[model samples]
Target: MSEALNRNYRLCEEIGRGRFGVVYRCYSLATGDSFAVKSVDKSLIADDSVDRQCLYNEAKVMQLISPNPNVVQIYDVYEDDSHLHIVIELCNNSDLFHQIANQVFSEAEAAAVLAPLMAAIAHCHRRGVAHRDVKPDNILFDEWGRLKLADFGSAECFREGEMMSGVVGTPYYVAPEVVAGREYSEKVDVWSAGVILYIMLAGIPPFYGDTAAEIFEAVLRANLRFPSRIFHSVSPAVKDLLRRMLCKDVSRRFSAEQVLRHPWMTTT
Candidate 1:
């Protein structure tokens, strides 16, 4: 597989790194078109471990939910004795995290960034995939400035009417139910997306803490607030949508589809 990958694409400069692998910029040997390849270290995945399962699940889930404009496209996968390589769309604008970290965001700007994501999540839910992790770091922008959702390593497949367990997600964006270790549905993704919206509009997370434990504690409380200093100019329509998306009660929380239909999302 290594030889095959080398023959098909020339893996070049390191672009990013994660828990088990490093991402490299690669080019198609036949056409010279650029792409990003994530090479996961096979040795780090213990047999029958959650990490091993997630390694394969990432590819499987991405393959299932892609071809949509907002989701990163997976091209090919190869594995050798030491590494597993996944070729995916290259997002040149870094990630949403870095893109917004130093800037102020308006409701219109935030909606532009979030609408496609919510639409993508709605598509995933319709296909039975729950993107257990939905944070700014996992959102990227392609060369055309299209928002692309990347990284399905923490994703899971579930049936409608059924719930999933086992906590999974980044602290700041994890759903309150996930923080409480309770069964959660795909609505968890909605919650995480809501957190991103909060950060975008206010330039800070709704729940905060100095550590993971403190963050989880804050999440469990599920407090939703907007400081007047920052949100005084924000509209009620957008705030209403956020409250629904970030609702502590899963039953009251907006689904991704519902989010797409919200007034703010549809407004010009």
Candidate 2:
């Protein structure tokens, strides 16, 4: 830990762990506010590795897109000879994956959950930032149960009219265009969000397989279906929205802003 960080905050117990770092509960010395600090060991990151680039980009991107209530906020950053420490607001409640594992949500309930996420994605896209990875595991909740989008290790910046090429997302949540190894735009986040909505409503992924390869095959096929047994009660309006979002044709997929304006999203 840097002296500056230690001087201003008292680092406490480990709260979480990730690929390159451990998250610790921390407290601000001056205001006594609670925060989470992700300490990344510099030694673990190779100089030219994508992980290293994303680690640094995560801070820059969070600084750019944060302050939206739905997105996790970054407060401060510190660097030492040994590690890079990023301090951010803490979302005390568990992630959306755990919540989904517990219960399936109705269309109205799922809409309620997805509204803020769509808003967050819209905000990111408008800022020229693409989350790239928008799975349930990255959706967290604060102590008040407000949904918060977390993790930016796979995020990157892009121009308004251009596309980004990289297969950078969880298999089930990745867009078909991405799986096809084609240049893609910010709408990839919408595809992932659409997958999340599907999972929340059906308690299962729209595409599934025994392995990542099979899952990617299913995603490439992009045959979205609401099995009658599971989606008999789900409204057609939401289904239409899902079709627009999860469409295999990247050009036909809904943008994050379009998703927010959809009838299913608006009415709920």
Error of 2 at 226 (Å): 1.5
Q: State the local distance difference test value for candidate 2.
A: 0.93
The candidate scoring highest on lDDT is 2
Checking candidate 2 for backbone clashes, the offending pairs are none
- For candidate 2, the per-residue lDDT at 223 reads 92
Over 4 Å off, model 2: none
- lDDT by residue (tens digit), candidate 1, 74-192: 99999999999999999977789996798878888998999899988998999999999999989999888899988999999999989999989999999999988899899999999
Q: Where does candidate 1 have its weakest 10-residue lDDT segment?
A: 99-108
Best by TM-score: 2
* TM-score list, all predictions: 0.97, 0.99
